[model samples]
Structures are given as C-alpha cells and as structure tokens.
Target chain A: MEKTVVIPTDFSIASLNIVKSYVSMQPANARLNIILLHGLHQSDSIRSLLFYSKHRMMEELCSKEFKEACYVLKNKFASQIKTMKSDLFSGFTQSAFNQYTEANNIAEVCLPVLYNPKFKNKNSFDLLPYIKASKLPVEMVGSEVDVPMPEKGKVAELFFNRVSVS
Target chain B: MKMRIQIKTTLILLTAFLSIILMFSGFVYLSVSNYSYEDFYKLLEIRAVTTAKVELDQEGGSQEMIALRNEFFEKLPQEKDRYYRISPGESFKNEAEELGVPISFFNEIVKEGKSEYTKNSMFYKGIRYKSKQGEYVVIASAQNYFELHHSAYLRRTLVFAIIAAFAFSALIALYFSRYVFRPLRKITDRVKEISSENLHLRLDNNSNNDEMSDLIGTFNNMLDRIETSFETQNNFVSNASHELRTPLTAIIGEADVTLSKIRTTDEYIETIKVILDEAETLDRKTKALLFLAQTGFNGKTQKFDKLRIDQLLWDVKETIEKINTNSRIHIDMSLLPENPVKLKIKGNEQLLHLALSNIISNACKYSNNNVVNVSIGASDQNVFIIVKDHGIGIPEKELKYIYDPFFRASNTLKYEGYGIGLPLTRNIIRIHNGEILVSSIVSQGTTVQINLPVGKFEE
Candidate 1:
C-alpha cells in the first residue's frame, strides 16, 4: 500500500522546500502520496473567485510567485502530489486538517519547522508544540539556519529531518 | 552615654524596616527559585519528547537524529547521566550504573508516571512515555547552574538595597525626631533661665498652637501665682515684726516705770496692776503669734476628729463670755439642720475652738456691748457659721487685706487688737479644707462666714 503524508503549507518558497526535502529523503521505489494543504483567511472576493469558478481561480493562483513554487514541485515529484485549499471560517484549522488526514488515510503528518524572526534564540519547529499535543504521529522537518527568511532574490538553505514526538 | 531620642527612634524604625525587607527578600528568592526549577523541568520534558520523535520515527537514521540534536539542542556538561530507556515489560535491566540514576528512582518514575527531585545541587526530572512499541521512561538531570548563578546575583543586589535603605531610614528618623522635639527644647531653655528674681518672666508662645504652646501657657500661669504669693509673704513678715514689737515695748516701758520708784501700798498696787495688764497683752500677742507660726509650719501634724459645727460655735460663745462677762453674744440656732451629720465637720477640735473664739470675741469686742449674732446653718455639702457684728465695721477697701497677718483697718486704731486674729483664723480653717468669707461696710457692720465640708462617720 502507498503511504500518504499530510503537509500544511502557506504557499511560500520555504514551505515548498520543506515538502520537497522530505519527499527526496525517502527511500527510492517507495510509493508515497503528499498532500499540500492551505488554510486561508480569504476575503469575500477571493472566496467567491475560488468557489464560483475553478479555472479562473486556477489561472489566478498560477500567475504570481505561487505558480513558480507549484511548478517546481510538479517538475520534481510528478504524479505524486495533491493540493487543496480551505476557508478558515468553515472549521478549526486543526480539526479540518485531522479530517483531511483521516479521509486520505495518511500514514503520518509532516509539519515544517520554520524559523520565526521574533523568537531568534529558539531553534525548533513553529508547529512543534501543536504536533506534540496532537493524537497523530507528526514529524517536524527543518534546517539549521541562523536566519529564517532568505535575503531578497536569494534562496534559503534547505535540509530535512524528522522530529521524534512522544 | 544615654542615647538621644532621635537615635532611639531611628534605630527602632530601621529595625522594623530591615525586618520587612529581609522577609520580602526571602519570599522573592523562594518564589523565583521555585519558578526557575519548574521552568527547567518543562524544558527537559520537551527535550525528551523531541528525542523520542527523532529516534522512533523509522524513517530517519541515527545519523540524521544526531545531526538534528546537534543543530537544535546544546549539549550539557552532565549530559552522560541524562538518557531514556524503552522496555516491553513492567521491568527492565538496570541502567542505573550507566545513567548514574538509582534503580529505585527509575521504578518510582515508571509507577508514578513522573518524578522530580534535587540531589547534590543537581535537579532531576523523569517521565514515562507510552507508545505502541513499548513503555519508555525518560530521566533527565543537570546542575542548576543558571538558577544558582541568577540567585546569587539577586542575593547580592538585595543585600546592597537593604543596607542602603536602612542607612536612609536612620537619617530620616534623626531629622524627624529633631523636628518633633524642637519646641520642647525651646521651652526647656526658657524655663531654665527663670528664677525667683525673675519670676515675672514668661516663655515665648508665638509659634504653632500645639501642645507645646499649651504647656508654655500653663507654666506662665503658675509663675503668676507664685509671684503673688511671694509678695504677700514679704508683707506678712514685715508687719508681723512691727506687731510683735509693739506689746513688748509697752511691757518693758511699764516695768521700768514701776521699778524706778517706791510708793505707798495702794500706789504700788496700782503700778503693779498696770504692769500686769501690759504683761497680759504681751502674752496674748505672743501666744497668737506662736499659733500662727505652728499652723504655717505643720498644719498636718494636728489630729482631727469629727465635731458638730454648732457645738463648736456654742463652745466659742461660752469661752468668749467667760473672757468678757459684759459682752453680748446672741446664738441663733434656728437654721440648724435636723440631721446632725449635716452640721458635722472634720477638724482638730482645739483649732476649731480657737478659730471660732477669735471670730466671736472679735465680733463682741468690735461691736462694744452690741448684740453679736452667731448663726449656725447647714447645707447638703457643707456647714456654714455666720458671725455678724454691728460695732465699728471694717472699711470696704481693707476687706481683701483682712486675711494678711498683722493687717488692720485704718479706722480701727482705737480698737484693741494685735491684728493677728483673722489671719490665724483663716490659716486654721484653710488647713481643715474650709473657706472663710468676710464682707464689711464702713461704720455699718461686718459679717464673717465659714463653710466647712460635711464630715462622714461610721454608724
């Protein structure tokens, strides 16, 4: 049976790198499914554009920096990816994520341990506390960089490791 | 050396302040240390959970886990003693020697789910983590280095703060005590300067209207009374000497005249009678002077007993009549109370008799065979004796001076008196805690009233 992993994303390059690094580190010939989820706090116009028409909204989503990130993921890991977006007001983010995992039969939840500039001293995943509290087995993947975000027009260092949780 | 009030007050205030500061510092130290330990324990729990996630994930090898541990967690010097163990059963092989943890301590952690303690200045926290693979116990310990260093810094800062606060408090107390007692010191200096020669001088009270001003005002009033008393005493001594010398001069002059020549039996007898009369006057004046001196010196030495004032008045009347058979003393007992206790007074009987006789005889002597009215009355709190005379009455201007020893009315030069009677009577009545009131009208009459407190006696 193919193993499925759930990943929450904010559509940023750093988030995309986290998913790519996690998938590439897996053993070769091991069939895996990756779900990229976006929990959105969208305005009425954006919500209507996405819900009312799919093709137009898809074109809009493919226009900006998000298009480059999605394009990179497709070229690298073709036919092994799925993407979904949800409005935050419809349900709690954690509950929605849990339901999505259950429906997809996800083997584990993979969370990106992104650095927050405000908390410069701590070097841990942003979602580490939530994943530890959750019932599901979750892995926090991140790199060790003193700075969280890359300089303008520069790429951040990418490394991946699974965090152990009790 | 005796401690000043300022120093005493400052020390007391500083002691109290230091006690409170010490207590507060202790409480803060205890609370901060406790919070630090609790926070450290929470960090250890997070470390253990993160370690389990990396080691048991099945996807990441030990090299990746080690790399992640190196990247995120800082290695402690005592890291060898910190470790986690997983077992399939309730018991596991002893790892105490390797982990430097007691076997019993591990058992306690497994049974209780969590355990925390401190030994040799190092804090240890252990937790049991249950998973599908097996139950695992994670025990972590390290020296409380950060907490101890922080606490030491805190202790030094608190010590300096307490010392500074006490020093400031002592200075403040000294200033406060001096400010508070400034008025008392001023009054003391002013009082020290006053003497009998300058009894008229008074303290300056033009400052704040507080208790200090009241004390100064009261002292000034006392000085006024003392000055008046001194003036009266000076007058009494001069007058008494003149009065005593008059009778002595007359007795000596008559004796010299009688001894200068011999005469017939009738002539000698007449000369002797004159000498006897002058001697009797001298003896009477001397006795009155003696009584006045004794009453002034030791009024308390006289024994006192309860005596009815009316009976005392009757005795005076009898004594006066014996002295002057032709003198009229009318006793008016109409106003006397039915209850004899109301007329009772506490006094030495001899002094009361002497005071009454002096007043009664003076009334008869001054009235010149006129009816000398003696009235006895009683009130709820006192017995009143009124002696009324209608002879040569005293001048109104001399009424206040009547109680002075040897004081005499200017119009009473022809009256036979040494002027010691009223003053002696006043002193006697005063020692018995009674009052003497005299009201007189020139050429009309004089009235003397004596009020004595009603005496209490057993049934």
Candidate 2:
C-alpha cells in the first residue's frame, strides 16, 4: 500500500520551509502531493484559493509571475504535486488550505495552514471545523529548542519565586 | 541561634532558688537581730530596776547611792558584754569608765526618750533607761551582736554561689546549643558547597530524620533533575558540535577538492562559491548555537539599549532583498499602520538582529522559491512582529519539542542546521522579557509571532 500526503501552503518562505520539513518527514516509500493554496478576501466573507481560482482570482493564471511559480513547483514536484485552481483560502491562502486539509481520504498526512502575517489578520485559531471534517490525526513538530515544556530541574528555576496555588 | 530551652529552664530554676535563699536568710537575720536586741533591753530594764531600787530607794542616801552605783558599774568590766551610763540631772555619764555611754545612749534616753528602749548606734546595739527617783538615766550598749556577723558571712557566701551558678549555666547553654544545631549547621555548609559544575554531589545524610532530613530529601530530588538537565545540555552541545562539524568538514573538503584541480579563474570562482556557501552556513549555525547557549546561561548578563523595531524590521528586509540570489527567495512585506509604526523596546540589538535573521534565513532556505512575509507595528499596549512563510508546517506533536535543546523534528534535516535557530530567537526575545508564538500547517505555511516588552518595570 502506498501512502500519500498533502502539503497546503501560502506560498511564503516560512511555509515553503515547512514543505521542506515535510519532505524530510516522509518515509522512503511514501509519496506526497504539494498543494499550493492561497486564500482570498471575498466581498462578503472569507473564501479559499479554490474559490478565487474558480472565479479566475484577479486573473492569477494569466500573471506570468504566478505562472512561473506554478511551473517551478510542477517541475520540482512533477510526480508528487497537484496544482489546483481552488480558493480553499478564506482570504487568499489559509481558507483553501483548511478545506483540502478536511477532505477525507485525501492524504495520509496533511498540512493545515501556513500563516503569513500579511495574509493572516488574527493569531487566534478557528480550525475546529477543519479538524472535525478531517478525520485523520494532525501532528505538529519543531526543533528541540522551540519546545516549551520545562525539562528536568527547569521547573524550579523557572518558577523559583512562584507560590503554587494548590 | 535558638536559645537552648534546657539552659533557660535551668537558669530560671537557679534564679528562683537563689531568690528563695536570700529571702529566707533576710528573714532569719532580722528575727535573730530583733531577738538579740529585745533580750538585751529586758536585761537592762531588770538591772536598772534592781540596781536603782537597792541603791537609791532602799533607805540609801545620795552619796551612798552614788557609791553603790559605782560599785555595780565597776563589776560590769567582768561581764565584757555591756556599757552602763548614769547621768545626773540629765547630764549622763558612764560612771564606770567610758563617759556618757558613747553619747548615743545619752541622747536617746534623755533628749529623745522618757522610757527604757533598745536602739542601734554607730558601733553598738544598746538599751537606754531613765530612773525618776535618782534623777538619773542609764544607757547600756551591747559590746557585740552575733546576728550581724552571721548575716554578713551568709551574704558573702551567697554572692559567690550565684556567680558560680551563672558560669555553670553558661557552660551548659553552650553545650546544649551545639548539640541542637550541629547537624543543621553542617548541612548548611554542605549546601553552600554545591554548584552547577558539581550538582551530582549531595548533602551528607545523618541517621536522624528531622527537619534537616526533609530538606535533604528535597535537595536529592533537585539533584535528580539537575542530572537530567545536564544530560540534556550535554546532548545539545554534542548535537550542535556534530551539526557544525559536518558543514565545516564539507566546506574544507569541498575547497580542497576544488583547489587540487588545475582550473581557470571562472572555474576557480565557481568551485569556491560552493565552498563559501558552506562556510557561511557553518558560521551561521555556530553563531546561532552560541547565542542560544549564552542566553540560557544568564538572561541579565547582556546589556540592553533602546531599539527602534520598525527600523530593524525594515533593515532586515532590505538586507535580505539586497542579497544576490537566483530570485529563488523573495519577500513580500506589509505594514498595517499608516505611520512607520515606531515602537521603542529595551533589548540587545545584536541579539535581536541575529534572531530575526535566523528566522528569515530559515524561511528562505526551505520555502522553495516562496515569499517570506514580514509585518511589524505596535498596538496601543504592545509591539508585535510576524514572520511567516509558505513552506511546510510542523507536526502538532513535534512543535512542543522545538524549544528543547538539540531536538529536531523528524522532517527538519532537509535544511541543514544545528536546530538551535528558533531556540536562540526565543531566548533573545525572553531576555527582552517578551514572547513569541507560532501556528502552521503541512504545506499551507508557518507564521511566527513576536512581542517585545517596553521597559515596563523600570520604576
């Protein structure tokens, strides 16, 4: 059995770095589908990149820059990527990513959202809808240094002057 | 030092005992003295009545009376216990020998009293008497009082006894205090000797399971944690060294391989280009690792100056854009505020620069030609900066371990690193007493949120 994963992104460097990390996490035999998404600011509400692409999204496919980016991704992930014209991004990136992330049997692994400050309006999470729709487990990872749990002997030092309530 | 309860109790007991002895001695001395005076007075009254009756009123003339009185007084020398004075017409004198019974008895019998009485004078205890029939006054003084001498000896002995008791109690106090505090003081000295270099050493345990034992127990638990922390730190250090060594070796080996060939300038420049890139990478990783470690050791060790965050963000973006690349990496910046979003923060500018650059570089390395978006501005209450990328998002589980030392996610090897960039960034932000947060998805992208303090506690 072959396992496939989906990567949803906002087309930013940080999000692309995440894609590289995803490439590293894949097993030797596992394959991946790089889904490049951008959410758009719909007139009334948030819409995914799928919606914006369907509506021709300010003529994104006609833009040479976008076309070139699509060509490069297609060339890089020729066997492992699926280029879609979908506005899964609510503003232009994250909302479309949220939709594909929820599609069942879509992938064995899926990336939820890669936020760019210019694209993301707020820091609060509204991903429960996506989580409920996507029946698969999501696992987040970081370098050991970014981990927040206090390691051995760290609790006392961190809370050296703390008076615990209980 | 605690007051030894036993010594205090003993002192109180000793003080009570001595007080009782002094009170009893005073009562006994007063009683004896009073009895001695009363007995002498009774004797004088009896002698005066008997002598006056026989000499003056028993059919005796004045000359015969005086001769008889003189004869009685002459016999007083044999008693060696009394002095008698017979003053005629208030002119009292000692008829036997010493005149007027020391003048003290004369004053008492004639000038101060009209009746027989006993009183104390300069050197003697005495009784005074007046005879109406002979118009004479007799004053008899005691040659020696025994109670005064006894009480004086007793007072001297008691003073010496009190001094001896105080000295003995002090010795007892010293011995008891040492006995009580020996274990505790020893443990204190032992605890002071423990340091970061040797956290494995423990407090020496005694057989006693007292309060100090509880403290030792807690300290032992702390030692367990320190051991684990040291192990983690060691792993981090080794992992960093290994990560750094790989690139360094690669850079040197690549340069060596290139130079070994006879090549033209263009070929040489091309080969050196790759080597230069590798060297740059090793340098970046090494620098990030050191910065992270330094922050870990002490946050306050670094001096902070005022920083303009808006300018810093713009500067980073400008520098990144200016770097020569194949247009593979790009940045799209936005400022929400109409103004330049001036924010004054207190922090080490160097650390801030390093942290921001590392994040931006990480974004560039993994984005596969995607754009890095950065936004910086200040809200009324806070200053915030966000760096986001459309690269791969982190796994939910691995995100928690990102800040731990030397730990990298399973997917993080694609871009070679010592895995300390984010940690370094975080530590620097924390030194400024600020916070950084993140949210990401597999392919959608990742966003890093940074909030720095503005000298909140200077007052």
Candidate 3:
C-alpha cells in the first residue's frame, strides 16, 4: 500500500522546490502521497474578510489556499492526494497533525512550524512528542536557500569536505 | 682602433656617406684636369707670340730677313729633312718633294691666314714631316676645355660618364637597402600569431639591431608573463575541482541511505549518525580546502609574532602528554635557553603550534618501540627544530608529496590520515616565511628540518 503523509498547514509555496527535489530522488514505484489540509489560519484569513462576504466564501477561501499549495506540489510529482473533508481529513494544520499522530498511534511529520514564527523557539510545540516517539525517519523539508547538489567525483568530494552537516 | 658606437654607426650609416666621398673626389679630379689644360694653352700662346716678336726684332720684319730663313737656305730645308719652307724665293732641288708639301698645310697658314691643322702629319717624299705652325690648328677637343690645347677634353668625357655611372649605382645600392628591408611585414605577422598556448614561441630576432629587435624582445617578455598567469589559472581550477567533491558525495550518500528503508529507532539513529558524520566530514574538508585554496591564491598569511620558544614547546609537549599518557614522544630541551628561549619572531604562534604539533604527533604515532625526539635550538640566522622518529619511515617517492594537500602516500593508508596534516603544517610554516623538509628511507628513520628567516619574520 502507498504510504500516506498528511501535510497540514495554511500552506505556502515557498518550500515547493524542496518537495520537488525529494520526489525526484524517490524510487520510481514509491507510492508517496501528501494529504494537504488548511488549518485554523485559513479560518483566520476568512474571518478577517467576513464583513464584505455575501455568502459562505470563508470555506471557499480556505479551500483555495489549500488547493493552490497542492497544485504546485502535484505539478512536480507523479500523482497527488485528493483532499478529504474535516471528518476524514482532520483539518490541515500543525494542531491537526499532532492530533492525527496521537489518535492514530503513528508518526506525522511536523510541518506546522512553517506557518508561524512566534511558536518556533518553543521546543515542546506540536511535533516534538511525535518526533520523539516515532520510529520512522523524519525529513525536515529544506528551504529554497539550501545549496544545490553538486556534480559527482571531485566536486562532490570538495563539498562534503568543506560544508558537512552542522 | 676599437670602433666606438658612433664610429661603428658612422661606418654603417647608409645616408650621405658614399655621396660625400664621390662628390669630393670628382671635384678634385675635375679641377686638376682643367687647371693643367689651361696652363698648357696659356704657355703655348705666350711662347708663340714671344718667339715671333724676338725674331722680328732680330731680323727686321720679313721672312727673308730672318736668321732661321738664311739658316734654312744655307742648309736648304729639303726632302732629306722633315721641315717645311714658307718663303716664296726658296728653291727646291726635287720637284716631287716640293709637291709633297700638303696644299692644306700651306693654305692653313698662308692663303687663309688661319691657325688650323689637320690631325694627320703631312708626308715629304713619302716620309712624314712636322709642320712648325701646328700650334695654329684649332680643334674642339676634350669634353670641356678652357681655351686652346683642349683636344683631350672631347675624348676625356668618357671618364666623367664612368664616374656618373658609379655614383648612380651607389644611389641604387641605398635604394636596394630600403626596398630589401620589407621583412617588417613578416615580423609583424609572426608577432600577431602569439597566444598563451604558444607563448614559448618567440620572434626570430636574429636580424640587425634596430627598433624591431627591441620590439620583439619586449613582446617575448610579455609572453613569458602571460604564460605564467595561464599556468596559475590552470592550477587553480584543477585544485578547486579536486577539493569540492568529498562533501557533496557524503551529503547525497547519507540522505540516500536514510531514504532507502524503514528502520527501528536504533537503526534509524545509526543511519542518521552516518549521514551526519559524512556531512560533518564534508564541512571540515570544505573548510580546509577553501582555506588552502584561498591561501594559495594570494599568499599564505605569515603574520608572525614573537613566540617564547621554550614556553610554547613546553606547552605543546604538555598538551600532547595529556592526550595520550603512554605515547613515546621524548622532549630533549637541554639546548634551549634556561629563561624560556625568548625568541620573539614576528609569526603566527597558534598556527606554528599547529604545524609543530602535527609533526610531533605524527612522529610519535609512526614510531615503533622507539621514542620520538623533539629539539629546539637556534643559530644567528634562523631557529631550528628537529623532529626525528625511528618508525615506519616513508619511502623516497612518497616523501615528495607530503606537503601537497590531500596527498596521502599509498603506504600511509594503514595509518589514519586524510594527508592534509602535513600540507597544513607546511602552509603554516610557509606563512612564517619558513621552510620544512623531510628526509626518510624505508625502515631506517626520518628527519625533518625547519628553516626560518632571521629577523624579517614579520612577512
């Protein structure tokens, strides 16, 4: 069965390149799909525009932000995960991933921190417990600012010699 | 005489040289020839008139009254003689001889009263006779003449013609020199062909010394400099590529291995550790490589300081002792100054220590059962340090590459090293304007020598 990852967020496309790099390195047959869902930040943006809304456009706005992020990821990927509603999808947010991990007794990748800087210093935020308990490997998505992979042989060796992991 | 430069140049100068000599010689020759002909004619005219006056004064005004006419009658200027009689009363015994006197000669002086003469001598009885009035003959002769007696002038014009031909030929020689030097076209063509790859090929500058030789020399020197820079650039790129490879491979390998399979906690941690380890190694190697590359680019930072020799060595010795309790490294400091060897050279002490420590550590590590020896002493010009080890010494060929960054000898692979230690040590020493040398033979032993400049160590 394909391994499913839930990318919960008020998603931004800033990290799309990193996702693309990951997908390229994957095995051809690997069935890795992302479950993207917008969290409460979508609600916050929606509530801010509530005065002018003639209809229930808040749901539409949240869905739009979610869909756009998914579209960017899909263009770089072979196939993508279709969004499941709140009952099955667990609303997309860091809080949702935490809830999903605890409830399902499975590891959920901690991605919510990308949405807010205010909670960054707090080590006890949503992903820490899941990371500690999870048996599977967790890959923190690299930012676009990370250096590109170099050519093989000497170039590869030189990069390794000079810029090893911190 | 040894020709001076101006003299040599004067001899070789083409312009106005032969022209001056030709003009002077031709002027002298023409003046002398003209003066001699003029003097001959004036003397002839003066003598002729004087002789006629003397005769007229002596013998009254007629030919019959002249003594020469009476003497000629007493002797009778006849056919046996080769002289002519000009008197009308004179008698001739031989009528044939009388007819032999040329009518042209008689008419020349008597009938026409003209001083004209034929070039051929007249014959009396088939024998040639001289005419006394030959001076009366007039001929336009000599190429250019002053007055009478210039018959040579018309025939001598050939001399002037020959001279003019010679001078014209000299002028042609000068023109030939100007025309033949058309080689500047070839010289410039070859010069334009020069490039970095063929900088060693220079202009064939074997021609005469002039602006062209100097120009070729300057271009050849410029090519030398360009060639050096080209080599430096080539070396930089080659070294840079070689240095960049390690870190990248580790990053990919680590990430790829982790991405391969699902693992338990311990296995996952172990895998991540390898990845992280490789990353760290890459970082270190990259830093070293960058430092080495940049150092090589401009120059090594020698910026030295006054280092307390004994104190620094003691500190190093103490530090090494702490790292390994049983390492066989013996410090023999008997020759050092009692008060701390206060040799404050302008140098980088920390880097110097790094270099020394690397050397000392290697000696200790490579030694067998024997203890490695370290010494510090000084001469008037330079400080000396010897690090000698009786260990698995390096082979002759391997010793050459010790100072090259990342060049690990094939034999030294058993010992853990990236081979950067010696290169780093060498660089540090080099920055201090110092030299480091190693001499080793298989199983025999190894000795390292260090030489530092005396007081100009600040560089």
- Say which candidate scores most in TM-score: 1
Residue ranges of candidate 3 with Cα displaced over 4 Å: A1-166, B1-302, B318-326, B337-342, B368-370, B456-459
Task: In model 2, state the lDDT of residue B268.
Answer: 84
Worst 10 residues of 2 chain B by lDDT: B332-341
Question: Which of 2 and 3 is ahead in TM-score?
Answer: 2
lDDT of each: 0.64, 0.54, 0.49
Q: Is candidate 1 or candidate 2 better by TM-score?
A: 1
Task: At residue B155, give the lDDT of candidate 3.
Answer: 35
- RMSD of each candidate relative to the true structure: 47.6, 21.3, 30.6
lDDT of 1 by residue, B1-459 (tens): 899776787778778877987898889888988898888888766766666565544453867776888898886546433445555464544576565557777777888888876677677777787655666776667777666588789888888988888788778877887888888888889899999888768998797888888898899877755664554355566545644565466667767877788767887787677667656655665665555554452447666788888787777687567457788988876445556666677887766777787788888888887998777665555566777777778776777788755678898788877687676677678768788877666666777777777787766
Q: TM-score of chain B, per candidate?
A: 0.61, 0.45, 0.42
Model 2 chain A lDDT-worst window of ten: A157-166
lDDT by residue for model 1 over A1-166, one digit each (tens)?
3687766544344555667666666665556676654443333576665666544534543334344334434434443444422212123457755565577776877765553312111221243333345577877676554331111111111111222111
DockQ of 3: 0.00
Q: What are the per-residue Cα lDDT tens digits for candidate 3 across A142-161?
A: 33233322111110111111
Candidate 1: segments with Cα more than 4 A from true spot: A1-166, B4-17, B35-82, B86-113, B117-122, B140-299, B315-331, B353-374, B387-426, B437-449
Off by over 4 Å in 2: A1-166, B1-304, B314-342, B359-404, B409-416, B430-451, B455-459
**Tens-digit per-residue lDDT, A23-84, candidate 2:** 44555445555544444445543555335444464354224323332332333333444333
Q: Please state the Cα-based DockQ of model 1 relative to the true two-chain complex.
A: 0.00
Indicate which candidate wins on lDDT: 1
Superior by lDDT: candidate 1 or candidate 2: 1
